[model samples]
Target: MEETDHPQYCGIGIRGVAIGIDSFVWIALLFVAIFITAAFTGQLETGSPGLNAELSGAPASMALGLWFVLALGYHTVFEWRFGKTIGKALVNIRVTSEDGSSLTFTSSLIRNAMRFVDWLPALYLIGIVGIAVSGQRKRLGDRVAGTAVVGS
Candidate 1:
């Protein structure tokens, strides 16, 4: 019998692990960048009397803004260029179009952009439900972008 053209979609177990890895990677990178910048800017010097080294007020807001931009960029750029983030690559999986073709940059951007919505009420609960109910195991972002995560 001839084989059907169905794709082997990854389950939440593997996808969750991949995202966990990616989150760690991004956080580490963000910290490193912040440390280097602080060092260069004398923010880490702690040389003045009655001075505290802490993120607060403007600094806190700026850091939060930076984190958002960097995280979004991290996901969007990686998937757009490689069809997988470093985490997904390590997991031996990659994102592809529903038709099993390599995804375009717009597709990657659209999916990654919807990540915040997928996060839902908290901790990807909505995404989990979507994946569980979808025939292709797609999360909100995947369904919206017509993409799937599959073994590479």
Candidate 2:
């Protein structure tokens, strides 16, 4: 890790507002998925067709999966290309290592891929505790990847 005026600081500026932006974006994606499904397949009635029900679940799962992948893609690509995600861009923050170096692709993948682990045991139990207790607001993946989120 590199030393700076704020040696122990987390990255550029991924703060509460970034969290809010992430929530809004994800919720909008979810709702849009729902709306699109309904628009093409018909209303979600109690006694909907069985085939429709099955297709609905598959499509819903696909939509969620797509969102998951895209979110990672956005973060990885934007961060590497522009040093920010959409939310991070809006907030003027960037992610880096403790030494102020850009995160490698593998490192970014490890961090984002382990998001499932941090979200383990339901309700983000592990992640919540980790971030809360961590001095730099690092969750498991961040620690493992030896990276930090900071203001740019």
Clashes of each: 0, 7
Candidate 2, residues 20-99, lDDT tens digits: the string is: 57667777666655555654566544545432223357667766776677666656666666656667778867677667
Model 2: C-alpha RMSD to truth? 5.9
**Candidate 1 lDDT tens digits, 1-152:** 02128667998999999999898988876775565445544675454574333565666566666767788888888887888999999998889888887788889888988888989899999899999998889999999999999887
TM-score of each model, in listed order: 0.83, 0.67
What are the lDDT scores of the predictions, listed in order? Answer: 0.81, 0.67
Model 1 pairs whose backbones collide? none
Write down the TM-score for model 1: 0.83
